[model samples]
Target: MKLSIERAALLRAVARAQSVVERRNTIPILANVLIEAEGDEIKFRATDLDIEVVDNAPAKVERAGSSTVNAVTFHEIVRKLPDGALVSLTDDGASGRLNVEAGRSSFALATLPRQDFPVMATSEYDSTFTAPAPVLRRLFDKSKFAISTEETRYYLNGVYMHVADAEGRQVLRCVATDGHRLARIDAELPEGAEGMPGVIVPRKAVGELRKLLEDDEMKIEVSVSETKIRFATPEITLTSKVIDGTFPDYSRVIPQGNSRKLEVDASDFARAVDRVATVSSERSRAVKMQLDEDRLILSVNAPDAGNAEEELVVAYADEKLEIGFNAKYLLEIASQVDRENAVFLFNSSGDPTLMREGDDTSAVYVVMPMRV
Candidate 1:
């Protein structure tokens, strides 16, 4: 394949495509990015057999052909090219090398047959809908932190996305949990997404999708099927297989009867938790919260590392409540509160507690308490 593309445009396309290519691959061809040049555009495709990302950039085509080369190497070469310089890529099928040239720099990358690259098969989507980039970004960004990393419970290793009833309205929802903490976020359902099948978007796919949502004005087209899910923008398309498992019913995990209320500044609360946690042991980072009237005190005691306590004036009017929680969990959950103070509802020191930003029920978090 032979084509000339602007350095900035080429690097952006290749960088997005190659980010999914794993450096170490059992199959050599899996490490290569497929380059196809035709008409007035060039396409860069890379996959790890599970997730495939294809990006297209406008180019001046010299010859219509295709070639495969190391995704990482090609990305690095294009990245180092001077800004505004035109880059030329030529493939000598006979020599099995792809030549890259920009200004005074030139290098040839070993090539593989384009036929050896494994492209993920397409699927008949059950539902397809469009959403504002910022809406999708909030849904995934708020809940992804709780996705489980345990390989055994594969179902919990991704964000569970589906349609559900919220406050008598059907809303699109994303839920994720690692058994210790759970996050549930809801957005208004799109017109064509009523029949969308529930799918567990794998952890890696969630991360890849985040990069595409940086542009708030961009509209994303999302397609979902029983086996696969695809997110597409004008210049790029990302496709991945949905985890083949059933997500457990997570409704029971969200505490409903917890009524002891405590409202505290989210940022201040997070900072206080961090300071107290500094004295906590690495293994069990437990922080005790004492609440009475309008006062809240956070304390941590580690046998070998010493102890710390900090008092903060908060809005708590219920009977005195004391609870212990994993310091890290409290900090993470508190950070999600963006607009208003974080409101914490407690059932007891032993039951799961609910937290949310101000009075917004759209996004709710549940955390199981730990014994101090």
Candidate 2:
């Protein structure tokens, strides 16, 4: 195989492919990126058994062939090459090495037969739909932070994506929780996804998929089956196996009748919480909140460390309330509100609390309080 590709195009393709290649791989071929030069484009494919990503870039191909080269090593070499210098890759059938040449730099990298690459098998998707990149971005971005890191409850370690009715209309939804905090975000359902099956997208795949959604106007083609999910754009395709488990029914966890209302500027509340949490110890950073008619006081007290207190003017009309919560949890949930105020609903100090951006029900968060 022989091909010439511009430095920027080559680097972008290799960087996307190598993210799936683990630093320490048990299988030799898994450490390599499968490169194929054909027609007027080159394709770079990488996989880790569970997830696979393929990136396509335009190139000047003199000969049509394929080879597998170390993804990490090739990426490093291409990254160091001078800008605008054309990179040439060549492999002869008899030699076990691939030649990389650009400007005044040259290197011979070991190659594995392209036939050894483990390509994931394709399946018939029960549902396929197209969504704007910004819509999909909000669905995953607002919920992924709450995904659990616990291995035992593997079901909770991903975002549960499905179609559900919201405000008398069908909407696509993403829900994630770690038993302490829960995030639910909703987007308008696409035309062909009415019958889509619910699936749990693993944390790693969610992160990798995010990189593809930077363009707000791009439309992403999403395909899903019982066992697999695929997201594709014009130049890249990402496929992964969905987690095989049942997500707990989260509706029960969302508080229904919590009427105590507190409205505060999201930015102000976040800053106050952060300031008061400084005196908390590393072990169990807890911040106590005291609410009255129109004032809120955030305080933190740690026996080993010092104490801190901060006050903010808020809109609250319910009875006096005192609640304690994990400092990290409050900060995380607060950051979700963009330029709007964060409205919180409470039933009691021990009961789970609900927060949302202004009065919008499309994105809701529930956080369990900690003992002060």
Candidate 2 lDDT by residue in tens digits, 49-106: 9899999999999999999999999999999999999999999866999999998899
**Local distance difference test scores for all models:** 0.93, 0.95
lDDT of 1: 0.93
Query: Which residue pairs overlap in candidate 2's backbone?
Result: none
Off by over 4 Å in 1: 281-284
What does the lDDT read for residue 230 in candidate 1?
97
Error of 2 at 299 (Å): 0.6
lDDT of 1 by residue, 221-303 (tens): 99999999999999999999999999999999998899999999999999999998998667358899999999999999998
Pairs in steric clash, model 1:
none
